[model samples]
Target: PFTLRDKGMKHMVGKNWRDLFDLVIVQAGKPNFFTDRRKPFRKLDEKGSLQWDKINQLEKGKIYKEGNLFDFLRLTGWRGSKVLYFGDHLYSDLADLMLRHGWRTGAIVPELETEIRIINTEQYMHSLTWQQALTGLLERMQMYQDAESKQVLLEWMKERQEIRSLTKNLFNPQFGSIFRTFHNPTYFSRRLVRFSDIYMASISCLLNYDVNFTFYPRRTPLQHEAPLWMDQLCTGCMKTPFLEEMVHIR
Candidate 1:
């Protein structure tokens, strides 16, 4: 899947951006993709074919590593913090980009829904357990009416109150609010569009603050306000196969 995606992306850009842009960096292999200076980027043909011979002789402006981000910024003459780096991973993309370069950073979590759903499921499980325990105790109290049993029931009631308190604590409003942000179909759909716009603008500003880059915004027109089946499946599939199969069989 990654190979196909990369191929599509490489095909789209081809050698065009190379000529149009002031500088073009290829095979970035980001987030430790370029950590080792020994690893060289093999120049690619227009069709994304590798030219290894040219790779070895590649020079500083052409291509080289031990190439720090600061050096790249200075060389590019990027004068301001207007440069924004967009990456999907929080730690690798935003964390490293912001920490190392202080560049404007936009982090994309493609599996936003799945991450939220996983959190919601965990909360639901806790809620279910507490409800079950409380109901069971209530049933037991009604079934037995002896003096000793009634005293036991009173203690159980106190325990039930504590359990309810614990449950409330377990399902905190702040945490629930975050989870609910994703679950609310209306809210997420609106936010997703806004997020894409914000990301693109941020990236554009970083590349060149005064210059305008082509902006192509498409919603892909979801059939329903909620995420479609494929989006959910694609996002959910990011989990380990064992975890996916566990849900699949049930």
Candidate 2:
């Protein structure tokens, strides 16, 4: 599921585009592209610059505009999970393709590149380390009802809140990362998981692997199944579960 804009693409328009896929559709407005069956298909000129007459049949080496999915399936006989569609817009481009048509969806999340870079920074790692320490101290505070211990717990809680804000600000000063808001997944992240079979920074990432390569989704640890930070600390692994979660997100 590669985009036309990928610079590293081996097959491109006016190059080896014919060898790339069985059919190519441009300006096929979607989710309507999949939902609307009555929209007539139009032809694109040889240079792929201007629209021509209405087309009844699809042909290789030729470009088309605003084609319906009904005719596309009937003509090409491509349907279900075999058809892997790639798009940037989650709802507009991919939701209907996956949910309605049963096509495997690949989401092009360009923000992934920047988010990964920020996650790898020393500042982000340091904040996570301190946050884990504060969490452990706060858990122990429940056993202490003394005034002095309560005062110390309050101070630690304030510091923990500051660390949380700082960690969020590392990715963004406003909304934070699209994948997360603090430790929880953002609304966008939830939708991304629902709509897409897989996601990457760019469609060009497909070049890094073989065509037949199978990508298996990792089984995320449930809340009840998650090991405590104290257990991980005793095992000498200071890394947070969120770090491991991030690796599996893509």
Best by the TM-score measure:
2
RMSD of 2: 6.7
Q: What is the alpha-carbon lDDT of model 1 when measured against the actual structure? A: 0.48
Provide the TM-score for each candidate, comma-separated: 0.35, 0.78
Collision pairs in model 1: 29-33, 82-206, 83-206, 84-206
10 residues in a row with least lDDT, candidate 1: 234-243
TM-score of 1: 0.35
Model 1 stretches astray by more than 4 angstroms: 1-7, 10-26, 52-71, 111-250
